[model samples]
Target: MIWYSHVNEDSLPEIVCSTGYNSVIAVAGSGERLIALLDNANLEQLFVVDTNMSAIELLKLKLVALSELDVEDYLRFIGAEEMSSRERMRCFIKLQNKLESSTIIYWSKNHHFIKKGILYIGQYEQFLSKARPLLKWFLGPSFMKVFNNDYNSFSKFRWKIVKSVFSKKVSYLLLGNKDPAFIGKGVDTSLITNGFQELIDKKEFHKSFMAHLVFLGSLKQMDIEFLPASQNRKILKKIQAKLKNREIKIQFINNDALSFLEDNTSTTFNFNVFLSMSDILSFHKTDYVIKCIKALKVSNKCKCAFVFRSYLRNHIDTDIIKKITALGYKIKDVSNMESTKMYKVHLVEKL
Candidate 1:
């Protein structure tokens, strides 16, 4: 099952990798960030890796759609606009030839997800969709203000009320502890008891599509525009053209990233230029992540950049910071620049 149908992380890869990198290694969360990078960065190779096979399939489907469909049609096909199952299937037919045999079979078997719009098909997304009404009922008119982005009237008392309802108790009652949403996609519970708390606290609900999805259950046109790669037509078209012309190559690998790095120590490809972890750090302990980082075979001369995010603050503490610095990298906290205030983003560059 798809854990994340939409990526919550912002265009961090595009930002850090824009310093003239020819290739990128990214965790394929929902394919959105990869699309954003493709649109914004000039790259020759992109390695999209994910442990989830479904996530890889979603990325493949998106790539085929970009190669085949126009901006509007692509949007509709992916469930941005209202389109019937039959119409969606028709659109899928156009993309079928471009997809792998396995990907084609996967989508054909799970056509229900496509009919509902691939964008909202994730397990976590569906949980949010189902929970939206209850959230509205619990918060009353204050819920509407989240969508409207009107925080001036949202009082501290109301914030307390909001916090109570969105507490770990209620979330566990609604969605089991195993659910990706409740677990913060593999993060420790204490690290992020309530995923929406950060955005609400930061008063950044208006600027984040993730905030809209968590609070409103659906997206507005403005939210879509604010999203990383959804509505950037000219860039998308340019990327689409380049994709069709075979200028860029994207490969999807379905394997644990740490394992992939550790086992493939002899691989010739150098991941030294750019690596966008995309919150995958939360899945494994800091030491394990360090082991994986150590396993990476990078170019000695080329300056490398590593990007990662954590939900809570000071996740990479003094010891970890010292460890990373010893590895010849300087870490910068660019959390303020992230569109979604839900994460503390770290941009690490080789010194």
Candidate 2:
């Protein structure tokens, strides 16, 4: 199944989906997080495998529903056409199945912009206490653009000297992609601190602490450390639904790669690439690697790409690099220009 939804409004679950699995195990319609990684790695089929038909049914329902829409209509259906504080909170709460408790508490309790949510959704007031500041007028134009969630069109952002970097279009696109090259990918970014708690970036998140640092003072109140990852009620609901359906397979051992072996079973795969990150790392076992490599190599359809990471201080041994390079994969250096944004991924796939 295939779908196209807006950057933030889309309903997609993340997972560690693998390619060259020897079969069309499954495809997940809500596999938003996995799709970018899977697409980057270039896999062929996602058969939608899951022990729980409930999960498959849910994603299938979403995909079927979305397949009928272009991006704009879906945006409006999710309340993106107008960024009402009420609508925002409503939509966010609707996603509670995919969110966490911490995020719900954080949004309702600490996110100052969310008090209107309490006003809008009478359902959550008892769960919350404090109210957001009356600063809707104070949030600058740049903040409005973000509030609008006009996340694309980075090519036109021209206010280099005056606007906050968050106001730039590039930051928006990179933010949506979750690619770490953007400053918004890390500690200061919402997706990290907001998406998953354990994954929150600790170094540079733009919290009250960062705000305090900018304005030096002889004596002032300050919140030094970043906030812990908050659970979102929306994500939890969605996750619960997805887990109930059972399409994603995340067991570690059951999943790997090398080349000498071949599968003679009659099969056809519309593969464009086979990606790998661990190439004879000794940790990934040369034999499994060879099997994976051979499966892709034998396929008449795809090529491969291999991406790996190294310590900042270490250079790969030229010989080892060359030997892997001999497998016909090219190497490219990744630059983390957006320290705040985050999509830390590496792969070896059909080039």
lDDT of 2 at 127: 13
Q: For residues 1-351, write the lDDT of model 1, one tens digit per residue.
A: 787776556775456555487788888988887787775445788888899999999989988887899877887888766789899989998788888999999999988888888988887677777666775676677556755777766555665665665554456546533453345534444433244566666666676676666666656545445656644676678888888998888887888877777777886455446777877656665665466567777777666677877663226667887888888778788877776655777777777
lDDT on C-alpha atoms for all candidate structures: 0.71, 0.31
- Per-residue error (Å), model 2, residue 312: 15
Best by TM-score: 1
**Per-candidate RMSD vs. true structure?**
2.9, 15.4
Candidate 2 Cα errors over 4 Å, as ranges: 1-30, 33-58, 69-72, 78-271, 274-297, 306-328, 334-340, 347-351
- Compose the digit string of candidate 2's lDDT tens values, residues 164-200: 4443435445323332222222223333223222212
